[model samples]
Target chain A: MGVEGVEPHYQIVVTRDGSLDNIEVQVEVSEQIFSDEVKSLEKLGKRLQTEIKDLLGISCRIKLVEPKTIQRSEGKAKRVIDNRKI
Target chain B: MKVKQIAIFLENKSGRLADISHTLAANAINIRALSLADTADFGILRLVVSETEKAQQVLKSAGFTVGITEVLAVEVPDKPGALDLVLQVVSKAGLNVEYMYAFTRKSGETGMLLFRFDDQERAIKAFQDAGCKLLSDEEVHAL
Candidate 1:
């Protein structure tokens, strides 16, 4: 979901009233980064789901959306904007 | 003269940065400066901080692969050729720069830098002797 020279960030959105929400994942990478990582992101999502539920002890049904591109930040990208239950 | 930054080995994926950042945030550890060296499937999360030892412990306790390294934080301008100048200085000292990334934070006039060299101790000595203004651990952490 990220291109080369870019960092990837994801938005975790949860609606109390059951509305389709847009959780933005900004991945800043090079142009060549997107061709790969699509499948792996899906797998990574599954792994995160398990880890979050187990370690953090949170049980919230989440959905995986397509990865989006983000403008490159110099260093240390601010990822994981959790709008869910905020 | 020289400072250590934690280099965390991570398989590139979603939530990887989140996992570390969230943990650090939860522990009241602030990231002073950081970068990630990413290959195809793996990346090294490098960070300078006020508390290097504690940050490494927190990260390891969370099951992260962590390494402590001495990196050179050179303060250069944010303009073009600033990197070139640093390279030239390092090269003049007969040092091979393994990698470098722009700093995450900056003062009003000076920008910070993170550099990995083939030989950090020698490079630091040379850079400092050459008046390269090697940032102290406190300087890098203040970033």
Candidate 2:
């Protein structure tokens, strides 16, 4: 989510499978302005996955979505979508 | 010369590409050349259109995330070993090619190759020194 002059939109989707909990980070990255020269979208996803693991101590999957694809709440932003309850 | 290429972000859902093409067609934008690089979840569609600015504007208005990138358009002879000659120059110059795609004209002995280099300035210089013919934005649009 390293975009300049524009706010990066993202949403965290948490789910559970049997006994393990999984987290998925969806980031909006359309422009080719990555400082590290990430050529492909897959490589950018991998880099963001590594960063999220380092910061949260929980390995998660990265999903690169189009800008503004994530829904925005009116008052309080609902950044995390918990699908584990379902 | 540098050519303006439109890069679009697309989801991996079906009919997304069709939607983009339909949008462009409805707006009278002609896609001259294009390439798609994708992951499991998303894809980047790079296109050289007849009108870069108009295409970008229309695509954005149509709700597609679009960005314009400057890529080198080299004219390569339409024969064996021609591509190798250009690659040789890039290799000798220590230039890193991020991605490249080829497109041919209906009636021409030379095909066009669009290259996105890590170092644009160095790549341009290398191609120029190697006596390669680069297409300008106007040339690409006309094609």
- For lDDT, the strongest prediction is 2
- How well does each candidate reproduce the native contacts, as fnat? 0.00, 0.36
lDDT of 1 by residue, B82-118 (tens): 7777778788889876666676355446777777777
Per residue, candidate 1 scores C-alpha lDDT tens digits across A1-86 of 22232334544444444554444332222222322223443455455566567876675443432224333357865445556553
CA lDDT of each candidate? 0.64, 0.82
Off by over 4 Å in 1: A1-86, B78-80, B104-108
Error of 2 at B53 (Å): 0.4
- Each candidate's interface RMSD (Å, one decimal) is 11.9, 3.7
Docking class of 2: acceptable
Give the TM-score comparing model 1 with the true structure, all chains together: 0.58
| DockQ, each predicted model | 0.02, 0.41
lDDT of 2 at B4: 91
* Candidate closest to the true structure, highest DockQ: 2
